[model samples]
Target: MPRDADATKERILAAATAEFATHGYAGGRVERIASQAKSNVRMIYAYYGGKSSLFDATVAEALRRMAENVPPRPDDLAEWAGDVFDHHQRFPDVLRLSMWAQLERPEATAEPSEAYRDKTLAVATADASPLSPVDVLVFVYAIAQAWQLSPAGLTGLEEATDESETVAARRRSVVIAVERMLQKGP
Candidate 1:
């Protein structure tokens, strides 16, 4: 589309991301998103076809950003766990969007991300473990996946305490323990 149209689309998606993340799909409204975006409702329909399609586009864009944020190969799994938390650091909204998306649309759970599976399979196969491929796959990925309260992981802890060296050290310790568990035993 034209330059103006493209910019308008981006604005709408940004506004919709915040709206849907907060209120979820059922409660989210197109007019409110349009008002926040500073464009009218027709522009959203013109740019994104409809609200559902716009929501999909917003989610796809968020997922794309998150994929770019993580390590291609998590060689040090504890560090990987740290990195996962680090990836979502400060931006709890991304996690909020993910959780809200899952609750609002259960189908998201079964939607196959072939690229995600392939990256995971590669990591599992590389761990140099005696466990079966499937077992290794589940275990290794699970190590760093952390509690999926949202993409941020363990939202309660982050929200409760202010950032400090002591807290950081404790988080490191916990992640290290989790990583070690994945490494040892079957």
Candidate 2:
């Protein structure tokens, strides 16, 4: 593909990601994405076949980026959780997109892709513990995402002295918790 075409596609994906995150697949508008991308609506359909396909492509790209940039490190689970948390902080849209997928596309069924299976398998066999690698992963992902929603980690807390302080504290908490889990015995 030409450089210009690739750039245009990226813009479309960016716009589409934001749109899906904000409005979900049911509420997201093709016209709005096109407008945001400064491209014609027709091009989206031409490029992605339709709104559903565009959403799938948008999510696929997000997953691909996560798998590539934050591949799990089974040997160092704490660091891996921190890296995943950082990725979530950097690309908050990915979390929103993931939430929208769960809430709005509950009926859509697709088997886990090979990349996902490999990562889960890697974690499962990386160490011996009462909890399986898959369970540890689930625990880490849940806490990290929950922290994103409430960085203070509990209700009725005063705001942080600095935004980065809250993130640092939350990251530390996640890392420590995962490390402890890794040290547990069956």
Q: Candidate 2, residues 42-143: lDDT per residue as tens digits?
A: 999989999988888887787778889888787787888899899999999988887787787643213236666787888778764568666777787876
Each candidate's lDDT (Cα)?
A: 0.67, 0.81
Candidate 1's displacement at residue 160, Å, is 8.4
Q: What's the CA error at residue 19 for candidate 1, in Å?
A: 0.9
User: Which candidate leads the pack in TM-score?
Assistant: 2
lDDT of 1 by residue, 58-141 (tens): 777776666667644545555655666666554556666776777876554334365467656766657744565455444544
TM-score, each model?
0.75, 0.88
* Model 2's TM-score against the true structure: 0.88
What RMSD value applies to candidate 1? 4.2
Off by over 4 Å in 2: 1-3, 106-112, 151-159
> How displaced is residue 74 in candidate 1, in Å?
3.1
